[model samples]
Target: MALFLLAFGVWSWLLWPTFLRNILGDEQSWSNGSPTAFLWVHVVIAVVSLVLGTVIGVLGWRAHRANRRS
Candidate 1:
């Protein structure tokens, strides 16, 4: 579980930034010189996922270290 969480976090870290960059660059991401709903929604999702992934990964890492110490 710890390893899984770590891997998930890593994957999120690797994926979200690139995904966001792509989303921002895509013509469909904007409308009339402003960002579209699609862009906003994806931005929100990416931010939430990043926060959750980091928190979960940290918890998992702490648990793993605690287990090892015992």
Candidate 2:
């Protein structure tokens, strides 16, 4: 969806570099330690967006079906 694409673009611009650097540096490797800030940021964004998008999609689908039946 348009919203998802916009969100992804913004997220990539803000966090993609940090994520790549963290992984390449091995900062998140289990042997080195727990995950880094980059992973956490991505996780939070992903979870929140997924949940919100699901809700919105369901609502929109229901509305569309209702309109068609009327």
Candidate 3:
């Protein structure tokens, strides 16, 4: 479970930029309303992803330790 979460977190981080661009209209080359608005959304997502990734990585490490002790 931890390993899976870690992998997913890494994947999310890697794709985050593209996701941000898409939300910001970089992918479609068109804006929904304002670039600033979309940029904020992107920033929020990035922050969430970072937190999630960190948590998952920590979980994976802990799982490894537990396995070693068992």
The top-ranked prediction according to TM-score is 1
At residue 41, what lDDT does model 3 achieve? 65
Could you give candidate 2's per-residue lDDT for residues 1-70 as a string of tens digits? 5445445555545654565455556655334567667666666765565666556656655666666789
**Candidate 1 ranges with C-alpha deviation above 4 Å:** none
lDDT for model 3: 0.71
Model 1, range 13-55, lDDT digits (tens) per residue? 8988899899899999999999999999999998998998898
Which lDDT values do the candidates have, in the order given? 0.87, 0.58, 0.71
In the range 7-48, model 3's lDDT, one tens digit per residue, is: 776777788767766676564334655456546766797879
TM-score of each: 0.90, 0.54, 0.61
lDDT for predicted candidate 2 compared with the true structure:
0.58
Q: State the displacement of the C-alpha of residue 61, model 1, in Å, after optimal TM-score superposition.
A: 1.0
Model 2 pairs whose backbones collide: none
lDDT of 3 at 43: 78
Instruction: Evaluate model 2: give its TM-score.
Output: 0.54
Ordered list by TM-score, greatest first = 1, 3, 2
User: Where is the poorest 10-residue window by lDDT in model 3?
Assistant: 26-35
41 Cα displacement, candidate 3 (Å): 1.0
